[model samples]
Target: MTLAIERPVGVFGRKDLPDDWAHEQVTYFQDPETGLRAIVAIHDTTLGPALGGTRFYPYEDESVALTDVLRLSQGMTYKSAVAGLPLGGGKAVILGDPATMKTQALLEAYGRFVQTLGGRYITAGDVGTNSDDLDVIGRVTEHVVGRNVAAGGSGDSAPMTALGVFQAMRAGARAVWGVPSLAGRTVGVEGVGKVGYQLIDLLIADGASVVAGDVNSSALERVVHDFRGVRTTGSIIDLDVDIYAPCAMGAILTGGAVVDIRAKLICGAANNQLAHPAVERQLADRGITWVPDYVANGGGIIQVAGERESAAMDQVRARVEKIFDTTVEVLDTAKREGMLAGAAADTVAEARISSSRARRTSPCTR
Candidate 1:
């Protein structure tokens, strides 16, 4: 049986998130002692406890923040399912400018909220947050993980995410061509944040011409200073490049841009790249091969989960390296079944999750 959540009627005067965002739990938290306003959305726990990073951003209002957390937590559920992790998906978002409002008291208060859920959701770092921040959260709750290596946790997920995108981009290229290589290919990357910057390092080293863009001038300047000869684009999405990597935020494929997209492939570290759930068909219709964002960005979660299990770098990287093969499999399944790759990937994930759920609930015990 499926559960249907009531839409936020007249809340934003428009539907902000997708219709499919019927989550298992959507929780709002506020601490007057620390001035913390947050939302935590748990999408599923059929596979295991939900594990996802907690993002901190200065959203315009509570409606916008709720919309973001709902979509992001749902994406994490799909991401975890498709990545073959033994965990489910959930996410927390702290609604504030991290630079101005982040304090130990606030994080500890937020940690208290996490503990109230009793480990059904785990929080890490995303956007304005960092590993040190998770360490602070950990001090208040055992549900939190993904701290710095010195703090007995995975150090950073940015590099792992970059590596995964780079590998999966090659796989996308190979599905179009006959080989997995990006040499001499032009790749446009939007958003030069931690993961985007690391991805640039791999692309340049792989001999691909890089075009970069960001709203922040400092980010663009850092890219120009670190890597010369790379083209800086006014609009990264409109670049006439071989591949388009949207590493910033989600919903890049909305607003009629999908029809005129010139890129041969779309593979990036961003989650929920599709604004609409059905947008994968649009990419397929446009003849653009898209490695589902979750599959491509699974490396970060893989790293964090492995580290939580006390796995070494070799083990973690070995698992992350499988993303290439998984990319190929998803594309091939889509092609053979005449469906969108994202949908095909969802089929695979749902099958695995269903089997797990059935086994967990069956009373045919020995």
Candidate 2:
């Protein structure tokens, strides 16, 4: 149950990075009354602000929690830059079960930790954190997103997120199969959470048949009832479908899931889809096209970062449509270079970051 695993060398070792890119910092928060402990890791600020969601989970070890925060925050950096946002990356992790240890005090304490960083990092809701939990953090600082509508914030990112994933899925399908629409195609959605359910809805509306699964019986039932064309299954990943949308937790695509996957294209809103780089390679070897999670699932961040909500949503839709173009581009690049989709994604992201930096620092801009 150790959270620590083999990772890129400098990912956790921030000291090795150049000073300009090495603003990586970590804060520890503890509420003696509630016995709640959490860690917030801010990765970089090359763009503008550091933005990432806060996740609450029962992490087995401190290192595992730290690693998750680091990797996710860095991924946020790439995601924002690639999506043409002015934010960097940061993330927070509470090493406890959300269903059991979550409390207002814990969230407030975590928000205080965020306050300590001034305005360098902003927090939003992740897998284990919700809008209600974010409301607690909002009491401590304005550096929070995903606030409830009653609180003058966009509470649920599910619909926007699902739209982005659907756009990416469409792009992937068209690029790979030359089909411009999802109609009549079978899509397997793993996890019928807020995002997953909406994704299923969009797919079904577009004439795509969906088979869904979730650990929550109520959620599964709701999806099945609302979408008459939809079917339910015990295990989501094992479903035989043309496309597999993973809206659940990270690392689900690791190990046997990669090899056993029957889907032609893998795309979803799940962060860190591949358990490791090797799994990315395995997907490539299996000829499964993958839309990088950070790139495909960046609509939520883009929506929250911009000032104009409607404009942001429109841009999110447009950007997500480009995921198809990017996916096709990456696939072509990989086939020519004999590389994995993940590596190609990294190359593209890195180049975009570099180009953005150069454009910003150019003499003409000055």
Candidate 3:
């Protein structure tokens, strides 16, 4: 399922960004005619062209959008590196409410901006965007992925992402309880959105008790209706569960939240789960097995990346299931070095990036 994607020769070279920025490129585009305001941040391209999703949200201001894109793009860099993919990291954010401002023309305008990058950035869907939106963008540029399967691109990535999280949860269970099963454990899931919904489905099938909480009542109701005997809770983090799954937005594991979490293991689909890196040390001190967010949530990216290369669905599924191995390796590394899991993951990913950098700059190649 893992196919080689060759990086374009000389397409990117290491350079310090403006203001000593660590990112490779940051672009801000505005289309007055279509009422589009967007930011695209390409953090690294040592492995290949930067690939990530476009998130459409109504930010309070451009500054907030900039912060989100930078953090997310950087996270993508680490995610791809640790997943052993030959892709780099980048992300885009459209500054508008999807419900009110999402139009075909607006998306096309965004696509045109993406086209300007000329393949240095490849985009898909995130947050408010979906496969349908990617189809619209595809009409403008060839650099889009994760479109509808009927449209010759991979469909929704949520299910594959959930599968990866389930595998990670199994790995974490093994590390903590000496078994790789969630058969009799209780899991508290925060966020029953696309990824969370499918994750709950898997956990239920594995015979694990599930209690979920979501801000959207309809999403929670849909889970209740579709699955029998599933419980709904007011606060997922406060529950006395064996595992806590934050499948929603990022920074759910803040300092205060980590102190109150009753779960023995923390593994979920959310990115940037820790509000700060120091929180990982807190979780470690508390004896909670916190699987790094990027390590646990690499499934969606792997699925979409395979779709970009025309890999079959079966192959993609097999690749995603390997999250179990990656998680176990990371946990083992952390324990052996007496470091937090997140720090250990960062060490592993950074080593890969550094090695790639060395290869790219070697005079023997030139």
lDDT of each: 0.84, 0.77, 0.88
lDDT of 2 at 341: 62
lDDT of 2: 0.77
- The C-alpha stretches of model 3 lying farther than 4 A from their native spots are 1-21
Off by over 4 Å in 1: 1-21
Task: Rank candidates, lDDT, best first.
Answer: 3, 1, 2
Task: Supply the global lDDT for candidate 3.
Answer: 0.88
Write candidate 1's Cα lDDT for 1-366 as tens digits. 111122463223334544543578878899998999989988889888898989899987786677677767877887788888898989889999999999999999999999999999988778988889988988889887778888888887889889999889988998997779999899999889989999999999999999998988889899999998887865788678899999997777764778778899999988778877556666777788888888899888888888768899889898888899889999889889988888788888889888998887789842
Per-structure clash totals for the candidates: 0, 0, 0
| All-Cα superposition RMSD per candidate | 3.1, 3.8, 5.9
Q: Evaluate residue 327 in candidate 2 and report its C-alpha lDDT on the 0 to 100 scale.
A: 62
Clash pairs detected, candidate 2:
none
Instruction: Give TM per candidate.
Output: 0.93, 0.87, 0.93
Q: Which candidate gets the maximum lDDT versus the true structure?
A: 3
